[model samples]
Target: MLRTVSVLVDARDRAEALVRGHEERLEAVAGQSRRRPRPRVYTEEWDEPLITGMRWMSVLVRIACSDDVFPEPARQPAAKYRIVTPEAVLACRPEVILAS
Candidate 1:
């Protein structure tokens, strides 16, 4: 099954230019970077009187993309959701914030 899926995915890549489209563009923009540093990022759900952040799979997305994603020591594989104090965020000093 794994071999079959790999073959199918490879065929799809040849037939479909849109496969990994965004990744291709981002790579182009990245320009064969050698010493380029990944930007630190923070993803949050809201910012009312309190601040909270995404954990586990959500945070994993940024890490996979090679971004210096923040809110370390996530309560992952345990609490899918968690809190992020302003102090902690400030300490991370993220270059980008994805608040949604």
Candidate 2:
């Protein structure tokens, strides 16, 4: 029917407009600087207890578990355990602390 066709056409026009808006936003973001801001240097000395506390340990654990920090192996079983290294933990410290 003509009415049904008109409704479908209107729906498509709205969808196309939404897609265009998304594409424009993506392009604008892509045009900006791609460089990551430098991590802040810590001037104040951290207390030994605070650094070794449960809260700090939890933050390190969360960062270690992130996919960016350690990419998951392809076709690996979900139940398989991956051992996190001390080096990896040290490397991601700045990112975790600065939240960059």
For 23-50, candidate 2 gives per-residue lDDT tens digits of: 6865565444234343322111123211
Clashing pairs in 1: none
After superposition, the stretches of candidate 2 with alpha carbons farther than 4 Å from their true spots are: 1-10, 35-89, 92-100
Residue 100 accuracy (lDDT) in model 1: 71
Pairs clashing within candidate 2 = none
Candidate 2 shows a clash count of: 0
Q: What is the C-alpha lDDT of each candidate?
A: 0.56, 0.38
Q: By how many angstroms RMSD does model 2 differ from the true structure?
A: 12.8
Q: lDDT per residue, candidate 1, 51-89, as tens digits?
A: 445464354444445353444534343333446578877
Model 1 alpha-carbon drift over 4 Å, by segment:
1-15, 32-37, 48-80
User: Worst lDDT window (10 residues) for model 2?
Assistant: 41-50
- List TM-score per model, in order: 0.46, 0.33
